[model samples]
Target chain A: MSENQSILVIGADPAGLQASKDIAEFGFRVVLVEKRDELGGAPIRWKYHTLAPDFVPTEKVLGPLIDFVKNNKLVIIYSSSIVDSYEQKDDYFKVRILNLKNKSVSYEKVSAIIIATGFEHFNASLDPRYGYGINPNVIGINELEIMLSNGKIVRHDGKIPKRIGFILCVGSRDKATNQWCCTVCCGISIKQAIEIKKILPDAQIYVIYMDIRTIGLWEKLYWKSMEEYHINYIRGRVGENTGQEKNYWLKEKIRLLEDLLKLCLI
Target chain B: MSENQSILVIGADPAGLQASKDIAEFGFRVVLVEKRDELGGAPIRWKYHTLAPDFVPTEKVLGPLIDFVKNNKLVIIYSSSIVDSYEQKDDYFKVRILNLKNKSVSYEKVSAIIIATGFEHFNASLDPRYGYGINPNVIGINELEIMLSNGKIVRHDGKIPKRIGFILCVGSRDKATNQWCCTVCCGISIKQAIEIKKILPDAQIYVIYMDIRTIGLWEKLYWKSMEEYHINYIRGRVGENTGQEKNYWLKEKIRLLEDLLKLCLI
Candidate 1:
């Protein structure tokens, strides 16, 4: 509770930004650090077109957090920085951060430390059957998100897809992968599918999932997508995406749709 | 599970529509009746602009139900009609519906009945302090929803208000009223508040509440409204609207902002 005591918040994402502001507003100096040159983290910097469940723009979602962090005088932002070392000194942490912006290192003694490095989207390239990096039409959810955020919901050839497909459980909840549900991808797919439908109303959207994890009130979005958008929900993971244009096979005729786009969301 | 058995569904609202469709899909005859000229109860017909928790268009919310009702041959709809009387036989109920369109009563023997009349907004006029009917600047949440749905989010005089205030617990949860918390009101106010903010970004929005009942997953909307939109949350209900052009009482000073609008939601 001492005014001189400080809190070191590593990563200036929503959590870190909020923690820094909340702590700083309570008469404590906060050293908020992030590796990105700008703040707002992945959800703001990248994978935020429309937020899940609500479908409002990411800008509106991150607006207040950004404003609070930017205006708080007590929050000292260390962009393009990382907490390199930590030493526990009795009741406090003596932390050394490599400040890449200044080409220098700085040390801070803080009563508490909050580690908020955020997360990395699963590397879809590791699972090659989907032909992620190999096929021009196949992309990961994060990539699709960035594309959608920038108003680029189309194939690499700059053609609007007549049918878009989402293969859920890309890296998570698999025997070979993390063996746990991502818990977020289902809602993301539902949200993105709705957005895509909004953009291309006649576009046939499909979700290939092991199970739609949208439970409780979040199920509203999934229901809305299925009922209103007429989004097709196939209860299986897509085994492959051949490099051939208009690939067709039995029930896999869904993959043969012209100008097809696929999102491998883990 | 006899195929010949029928179910009588009252009130062609979302619930009735869904019940009728569901029963009909299961190979049962459904007699769906509504006193209203059209389908979709109040939420669709009168109050819903953008639904809570997600904020999508009401048309999208009601679209699938409408589609299901329209396409199902087993689901017979009777608009401008009401369930006039019910007589129980050995097991099934012999129901008489007064067909207002034909000026005659028709009888139907059905196995069961489903009443989906839905809810009515508490008459804000009953709470005279809010000045709902008397004041031009004052309105209820239903009015605001209709306005939002129809792209008419403006004052009675056709001017956009720079400041909007919402008084929660308009009739419910009070000594003089129903004395039960209308759980939907809190989420409704939060959703409307956010929508208002989206429409008029510079508008100073306020929610005067006994308690904001948005809980669990629905809490996300409340958080977004407060954190992102900077909507102010006052802890007490407004005591008066006085029918004054610019009510300048101390607490009523919030209502005195230039181009002010007030919504009372029970």
Candidate 2:
């Protein structure tokens, strides 16, 4: 194939890998690039145990796609690489790809480019109110996923949490933090809640939220967490984490006092 | 260039239209088929006033897209058409296209086919507990969107709703109705609630839901509905809509009696 007929796909995430594979399957030469040394994106990098709604193993879903793209003859992958510069020409793109490891640069001419750089996990530490970095027990959903994936739902001190509370919209749905809702957090929390319940049935799990935004079929996780698992859903946002016995205190205007009182009593 | 190089795109919804446009832009001949006589899919067909989350006019988002696909020279549109039969050949598939309107059959060999038929609005009437069809006051979100878009937020009697209650997850996230959560309903309800509050500021809006699944950025709608619009959210699955005085009664397992009692008092 000619260099002008090649397609440059940036990022090695699930989306990028799938796009590259699909394009390569259409008999087009695909130049796939990943900034990191690894191919799989956030899911592989973050060590995501299972996906939301279904809780299917992350590898089970993304493994085959990643492997296919990595092994495909038509797909030429460059790890630790970044798109240094690009200019749109008459019918093709003049591109320069820089390899971070070897400090080498390669030039390529491609007809089209697909940028599929996925999102970054919201840094919970940015909003100090949650005490994510300060409090050892207070961990983000990403950390919790790793713990759950490893079959260890223990605190930093290696203690099983009897009363667990998931503070939703940590860095999301807040004018102070991020005005956008981290949509998957609700579903992830609920999925983790159900997983935790399966492991520790007697443990009480509560999800504190301004609104539970588990959109789409993932609503099953929300429903299952409530009905089957008996996980409690509180309709309020947590103001601050005082870290008193690793319990989250409510704001001034509490909506569900009964549940809060139950939490306090526990 | 050749007959086998042409791409067949089924459905003329936003996804299909966009797909056809993108493919045609890539210099591939695209056969765009729509079951309806007119293109532009559900949003246009349903007369959707505004989309959810942002509440942008449906036409504003889909208008340009439909127009581009229709006017594109590389795209050949077949309205009121269906793929009767398709057989995989050596390098392409021989597809028989049947036009329902003209009762004409056309054969084409296409290298690729994309099916982008969007979803159908859940028939709220399926679940009789909601009293959707029986009670004139009970209307689905689809109808509500059209009403809100028409700039009329009135009941069947053409009276402004003073105390409006949005029963969410009507045909979604229910064991009897649909096991999957109609993700958009929560955001749509919140959007409509805000729109209604804008028109009728004195109107009190309440969202009755098992779980508010407004995932991601749509969480803003949920927050705005509560904080700005003063729309109340009650946590519980509505058992039955007993349309007494055009009001809904709660189930035996009422979690928020305060809100329900407040409703009763109102």
Clashes of each: 0, 2
Distance from true position, residue A198, model 2, in Å? 4.9
lDDT of 1 by residue, B230-250 (tens): 999876556666655666232
lDDT of 2 by residue, A61-101 (tens): 89999889878888999889999999999988999999998
Worst 10 residues of 2 chain A by lDDT: A257-266
What proportion of true contacts does candidate 2 retain? 0.82
Error of 2 at B162 (Å): 3.9
Second chain TM-score, each model = 0.89, 0.89
Per-prediction DockQ comes to 0.01, 0.51
The numbered model that scores best in TM-score is: 2
Report how far residue A187 has shifted in candidate 1, in Å. 31
